[model samples]
Target chain A: MIHLQNVEKVYQTKTIETVALNNINLEVGKSEFVSVMGPSGCGKSTMLNIMGLLDLPSDGKVMIDGQTFEAYSDKALAQFRNQTLGFIFQSYHLINDLSVIDNVELPLLYRNVNRKERKRLASEALEKVGLGNRMKHFPTQLSGGQKQRVAIARAIVGKPKIILADEPTGNLDSVMGNEVMDILLKLNEIDDTTIVMVTHDETMARKTHRLVRLFDGTQVN
Target chain B: MIRHLFLIIWNQKRRNFGLILEIFFSFLVLFAVLTFIIDKYNYYRQPLGFEYQNVWSIYQDTKGAPKEEVFATQEQIRNALKSFPEIIDFTFTNSNIPYGSSRSITSLKKGDKEIDADIFTVDEHFASTLGMSLSEGRWFNESDRAAGYKPVIINGVFKEEAFGDEPAAGQMVEDYNDNPLKIIGVVDQYKYRGEFVKPFAGFFQRVDTTFAVRSLLLHVRSNADAKFEERLNKRLDQIASNWSFEINYLDEMRKSTLRETKIPMLIFIIISAFLVFNVALGLFGVLWYNINKRKQEIGIRRAMGASKSGIGRQFVGEVLVISTLSLALGTFFAVQFPLLKVFSVQAGVYFLSIVVSAILIYLIAFTCSLYPSVQAAKLQPAVALHDE
Candidate 1:
């Protein structure tokens, strides 16, 4: 489960101050697949980042699995992110220098997993995403859809409970987008993994169990 | 983790080749400078083998005088100098004084080995005047000249080279024309040249009357100074006005001899320091630029789970690996010097240079990588990912 109470995000510059997310409260239950839909500059990604603990809210208490994380140190936050949450960026964010399997093994590396076990787990995760055959291929050598698939494998490799995807299918074709959506749906239904996705597509939003819309830094529905 | 770091370095080898080459050349130059430093240090620690304190040399122009006049002038000078209580001892010779420039080499054979020995022709009092210590036999004496074969006293280095494991004092080695010369005594060490030069085989023979004595070495008392030298010169002039002498203190010559190596050593250190500094700056610039270029990759790793310190460590580890690869190539060539005995320096000194250079390069690489690595560590994953 994820909880955000009185969440406020402000982006300040020398000339102006912009409120990315105004005082709002929201919660997503365990294993629930939720989509946040918004137009450009509507604070959809900012809300997702706060939920993922990648960025802190200007004023809010973030509670995940009955624990508050507002006072967590940077190291503790990173550890929580590694152990409890996984991320899939709009750009895939796969390291081009490493192969697909090696990219998947990144999170486990921080856990001090031995090399052989990391390799085994990485291979199994890639297989789960139907990317076992391309495990040795680099991100540069893959198509946009395959790269996103590799990113998904990386996110799920450590078996984090909460998966935060920010426009995961934004760079892919319709067929590849549906394929990725199907994987996320199956993970939510079968593995009981909680998912929060930020997207602009109506069809993608309709596929999720619930939709929370944002317009100009406030929750609309 | 180190293996993974190595793999990353390998993956980026093409981008890192220039850095590797820079470390390679820097390491090579560092090794050479270190070897020269160690070699000179070892040589400087050895004793000069004779006391140069209170000793001075006088070069006389006897070529203008007739043989009888030259002999008479030298005898007159000797007697006059002996009368001065400040003058402890004096010997007349054609050339070689400590820190004085004159060399004569002769080849002498011991069994099948032909040894080229530095020959110093001096009178019976030359050894005592120079304060040379003997390890085996006596200095040149009156009985040595009349003992049949020509008498020669060799230093320990020459004795070891010409007569290994055998008694050198009673042995005889043949000259180039196959004439036998008896080794009368074995001196400990006779370093006439600067300390950087290796000790060579030396043969000191008694100065014969047939040869003209062109120089005089005086062992003056501790209080001897310029006034005494001025008075002695004036007295020598009175004895033979046609003969002009140039006086030089042996102590000053000794200091100048050390200065000869020190100046070059300083220049070498400055030049080497400049070169290493340039390499360090280049390495820093390259690493900083490379880290900026890899921000996205770093961001991805950070998002996945790498800590800030982990990122910094990875960057530093990559530079260390590249430097290690470069050092490997540089050291391969360096090892050949000791193996081949190139430059005739001691092998231990060369080995020590290799170790010192390796440590120096590692330190340079680590220092150069530090700031860039910390910058890499401070990069925010979300901001970096968003930019990409």
Candidate 2:
């Protein structure tokens, strides 16, 4: 479960104040698949970043699973993110120097998992996304769709409670994009993983359990 | 974590090869400089084997005086200064004082074995005049002047090398031509050149019938002042009219011997420090550039739950791993110098240099990586990830 109360994000420079997210309140329940749709510069990514704890809202309270984050230190927030949240980006963002399996093990490494167990879990996660055969391959050697699958494996390797996908299919063709969406739908349906995704496509938005639209940093529908 | 650091470095070895080489050369250069400094420091701590305070050397510039006349004039001067209370003791030698500029070397024979040695020709009182200690037998006396077999004193190094563990007193060593000379005593150390030069095989023989003596050494009583040189010159002029001479304090000459090394040692240290500083700068620049290039990776790690300290540690640990690899390569080459006896330095000096150089490189790499690592840690994950 995730909740944002009166969340506001304002970007201040010497001559201007830009409102990225303003006075918003929202909630996503356990095991729900939600999609946020907006045009460019309409604060969808900012909202996703705030929900992911990648950036703190300028003025608001963030509550996850009924616990507020107002008292969490930076280290505590990092630990919370490692244990409770996962992120999938448009670029895949897999470390190029590491093997596919190594990229999947990155989150567990920060969790102090034993090396043997880390390898075991990373292999299992890679298998879930059908990338077990490509465990030793590098990101540079994979196709865009395969890279996104690897990124998906990495996101789920830690078995976090919530998965946040920001424009996950922005760089893929329709066929590959549909393949990625099928994986996400299966993860939500079978594993009951809470999923929050940001998308520009209305067709993709309609498949989610709920759709939230934004215009100029405010929720419209 | 450290193993992970190693893995990353290994993965990027091609990019890191130049940094490894820079550290390798810096480590080697530091090893050499530390070895030389520690060797000299150890040698400087040893005793110089003779008292140099209040002693002075007078170069007896014969200026083409014939052999017989030079001998006669030396005897007259020795007799003339015998009663001057300011001069405690005086002796004649053939251009070999504690820190003299000239050297004399000759070979001594024993059966089929010929040993090359530094030779000093002195009077019966030379040992007492220089305050040197003898471990066995007596100094040359009037009885030795008769000279059926010439009386000689050999230093401990020469005695050991020529006759290992055998009693040296009363044994006969020979001149290059097989003329026998009895070894009357053994002196422990006689490092006449400087602290930097090791003690060599040496023999001291009495100055009897040879006018080759070119130096007159004196032990003036302590508390003698600047006026002492004036009195000494006056005394010398009264005895031998044609004795052109110059006097210098032996203590000053001894310090100058060390001073000669001190200057070059300082310059060497400064140059080495500058070289290490440059290497540190190079390491810093490389690490900064590398961190900047990996901003996205850094952000990803942070987003995935890496603490700020974790990111910092990763960068520092990576550099430390690289430095350790470089030290391994550098030490492989450095060990050969001592193992093969390449430069005649002490084994302990080289071993200690190896340890110190290893630590120095690790410290340099760690210090140079800290700022860049901190900067990497301070990057905002959202801002960093959004940049792409």
Candidate 3:
């Protein structure tokens, strides 16, 4: 479901140039769960950002679902992201000012969903993540594990074909981390959703269908 | 979308309360200042109904002289004014002159419909001297002295207040003493107090022959200057040696009256401008701080599919919602001025002030939010996500 060919990403400043990702070629088929592992400063997040279309590659082609998006405008790209991709960040990234339900309904807000339909779908997503009872609470009121669940609900509320998780369980305890991993496994196995996760934990990386390692901006395996 | 925005603001009410209060106070100040300005402008645009250019008011202080002496001195001054070629016309009157501090107010009654009105006593030459035109009937003359009732001329506003749509000429109204007063003519308008004051219900009564006239109005030629004034004072001294004359140019009196009204308004405007500027600065700082605090939320929205313009719209729209709430409260209080009759201004002026104030507040909010929101929109989603 995701394709990258010779993708190279460079970070430049007035006096320095740093290559973030170098000559990377990777592919994940439909409904496949892939995990990327790397040490700090090894460009793991940079590769995920490029694949999630959050950052552009310095050189090479990025195609999603068999279509290249080099000519898409910012608005078109945003719309494509809305319709085709979901994101989960390490910090959960829940708006503290909004309630759990409102946080879950955020992605569908950019779509054409009406208020009632958005509420219904957000409620369903929360229920699936065991957060139905906490929908009225704010992100500040929830624990780290519950906040990540809310983020997952938000990510899956739009029913995107692909979910890009950047350290989804990084802030949680091992038990909570296992719970979140189980939710992702169920989503992949039951809904046939494609998943690409960036993690540092070997245990979590081994749970995925495949693992790709990066060292010093280049894929090692 | 508006509901969602309002929900967000509402959920953050504690954080936004101070901002709401600031906007509310700004709106109230703007409303008050705008109302005062618009009311004054409305009054200024009206016709004062009588000409003041090239005219002078002479206050003849007799210093408690005998009544006959006062009358004789005013008659001498009138005759002396007629002799000068620079003098177009002159009339003897009481102390109730236009823009003067003195006033004579009494109630007039017509068939149980009574209204309070200012009273002015002048001679037959008063209208000609002051360049006043009658809308109906004629100015007072010696023929009116032989009539059964005292002749009086009511202005159009007094006419409407007393008689509504009916004709006022030849109508008889009674004075406070129940003495019959005949309305011989109707002047369209006579705003005697000054340009910044509303016209009141008032009428002119013919001066009695036995009454002492302490003031004289002179219609002079356009070329009359300080030299002519010096010659007239000399002539006055020659005619009535004991009487002291205080000559005041009507145009100069008008300028002084306008200054009296405008100085306070100008000061108020300066103060209001400072207040609005400070509010604008506060709003800009708050929006900037809010954007800095919410970078991660902005990044999340961007990652969730909001366009850059969408983020900009959200920030700007949030400020507009806050302004809307504040103005709503401000308008609630502003309408009380007209409803409670707090000021003598018209209701329409208060409503117009509310509209203008709302527009100004929205403009301030929009301007203050624009730059900060644009900077927020320019944030790179990947970088913003990593922001603590």
lDDT for each of the candidates? 0.88, 0.89, 0.92
List where candidate 1 sits over 4 angstroms from the true fold. Answer: B64-69, B164-167
DockQ of 2: 0.82
lDDT of 2 by residue, B238-277 (tens): 8776768899898899889988888888888999899999
Better TM-score candidate (2, 3)? 3
Q: Taking the tens digit of each residue's C-alpha lDDT, what string does model 1 give over A1-221?
A: 99989999999999999999997689999999999998999999989888887777899888997878867777777788899899998899887777888889989988889999999999999999999999889889999999999999989999999999999999889999999999999999989999999998899999999999999999999
lDDT (10s digit) by residue, model 3, range A79-132: 888888999989999999999999999999999799999999999999999999
| Candidates ranked by lDDT | 3, 2, 1
DockQ of 1: 0.63
Ordering by TM-score: 3, 1, 2
TM-score of 2: 0.94
The ten-residue window of minimal lDDT in model 1 chain B covers B379-388
Candidate order (DockQ): 2, 3, 1
Summing lDDT over every window of 10 consecutive residues in candidate 1 chain A, give the lowest-scoring window.
A69-78
Clashing pairs in 3: none
Q: On residues A83-120, what C-alpha lDDT tens digit does candidate 2 reach at each position?
A: 99999999999899888999999999999999999999
Q: In model 2, which regions exceed 4 Å deviation?
A: B107-115, B146-148, B159-175, B178-181
